[model samples]
Target: MAVQGIVTAADRIRELDEINGGLADMLNHMGQAIKALGPNAQAGSDDLDARKEVFQEHSRAAYVCTQAFHARMKRQVYALEEAGIILAQAHIHSATSSAKHKQANNQPVQGQGGAPPVPPASEAEHITNGGLGNLDVGWLNSRGNKVGMEKEAELLQEAKILLEDELERRRGPAASAG
Candidate 1:
């Protein structure tokens, strides 16, 4: 789904570029047309002058609007990145809980020959290791030291509760802010 979102964003950027290019071409042609009229006091020249002013205003407005659009697109990309991170964390928490639960129940994890199951590598690992390194999850411990294992299930549950609360609040009728 994230990949789809990224591809859509890329397509939209290409479209925006094409639109801006077309606008530039149109503005350039308009400028050339105005210059072809060449500073004459002939009739309809005043009308051309008025058209030139309107074109300039339109060009300015298009440029300003495109700049604002680019800013918004940047913010959207940042938001998507954040959402991906949060989802990844939640996934890790879920996987860790499943592994621990299975271990506690003395059940043979799937395809593990009765050994304890390991949590999957996290997004941070993929980013830092270039997709080829140890699969240890390095969550922070209570003293701020990095621990190469799963976080406590209680902490993960607490975070889940908080996120659920936030989601519920957002879905409330009186919700006016994120």
Candidate 2:
């Protein structure tokens, strides 16, 4: 009876570990995908309107991807919590069995003989302590985002300068009186 419970809990723990690994892999891939976006977007005046449209579309797509990643990560966290619970139960079972084993040898059930160990905090506890947003860029207003944001602003400034230069280069002479 108790043995079966122990086995079930162990199995649950292993499954959760696997899920966590897969989730980490997905998060890594998403990071790489976001990085695949090119840099130095300095389109000429002729293409300014087109470049603006492209930037807007990229922002929208990034938003959707960010949301999807958040949801998947949340599910992974929940799975980790579930696994922690199963592991705690397994620890209890092991302790109880040890107590039974001790008693069979005419020893006291814990205290007078040996005490069962308490389960340590789950790794999830360490992770959840610092919620999200370390790397998430969904909330642009966050001061934590200033680092890369400053660089982005600089890039945009350069693009604007390039557009002005292109405009000047393409400008024609003003028309005179007929």
Candidate 3:
């Protein structure tokens, strides 16, 4: 029964490892696709109005892609931690079972206890970041700030001003006469 339990935990750890690998591959593909967009990874145009629209579109695409990548990476980190815990428990269980079998056979056990040492409270803090320890929170906040309708409106306003100026220049005295 103990062997079966250990096998199950090992299988779970392997599955999680495979999932992490697949997620990494997926993230790499996403990065490649973003790079393929162009040198700027943004939309470009010669005209102000068109360029504004393209910029908004590009921003939305980039924001969505980045969010997805971050989410997946977070999940991967969580899965890795779960796998580690499972493997650790399996080890502890195997050690305890062996100690019990040795005692039953009147053999001396080697370790003081069949359990692992307790980690310090500081170590708990290290894992309590909710799998976001490696993430750049400030950068994400700045990116979030750049998203949504407000930024689009600001870009449109700038484009409108430029278009009006160009129109006035083209009209010259005719615009005032009309």
Candidate 4:
């Protein structure tokens, strides 16, 4: 747990450093863009260069810090991953041991004299209205009031009749016998 905490802290620090480095890069780009646009840009090359050098120094420092943080955090992550594997194996071993222990205990337990309790029955109930009491399959094909869907319902009914006629034509006894 302590190691996990340490690893978590290291991970956070690495993430923060990475974020800081990105922000620094963005700032550097903005600074260069501004210097490029301003009228006295060429005349102030020396001053701009000095400012650029300072920025470079800071950027390099940030990069070095991020790299170091990553290296350290990577080790911690590796250790944490290893610990997880070890912990999983330990749990498996403990579970098996517990199962054996339980079996040993249950040999005498033999529940109340002869056997364990039986489970209850599960009946699958039928539904109506599509579901209990609301089983309205009127919506199976559509949802429209008798007034509002008159045209659409007529078209659908005609379509269903057409489908039935087509199906019967294709599946008639003479068609199948051939």
Highest TM-score scorer = 3
Ranking by lDDT: 3, 1, 2, 4
lDDT (CA) per prediction: 0.55, 0.54, 0.56, 0.53
Best by lDDT: 3
lDDT of 2 at 125: 52
RMSD of 4: 22.8
TM-score of each: 0.25, 0.27, 0.28, 0.25
Q: Model 4 — which ten-residue stretch has the worst lDDT?
A: 118-127
lDDT of 1 by residue, 55-168 (tens): 566566656656765775656545545545322223333456756665787865553775445444454444433322233344423546334234566678889999999989
Instruction: For candidate 3, list the clashing residue pairs, or say none.
Output: none
lDDT preference between candidates 1 and 2, better one: 1
Per-residue lDDT of 74-171 in model 2, one digit per residue for the tens? 66555554655222222223567656665666756565434553223462353321334132445535657677889999999999999998877666
Candidate 1 residue pairs in clash (backbone atoms < 3 Å)? none
**Residues forming the 10-long window of minimal summed lDDT in candidate 3:** 85-94
Give per-candidate clash totals: 0, 0, 0, 5
In candidate 1, how many clashes are counted?
Answer: 0
- TM-score of candidate 3 relative to the true fold: 0.28
Q: Could you tell me how far off, in angstroms, the CA of residue 53 lies in candidate 2 after the best superposition?
A: 0.6
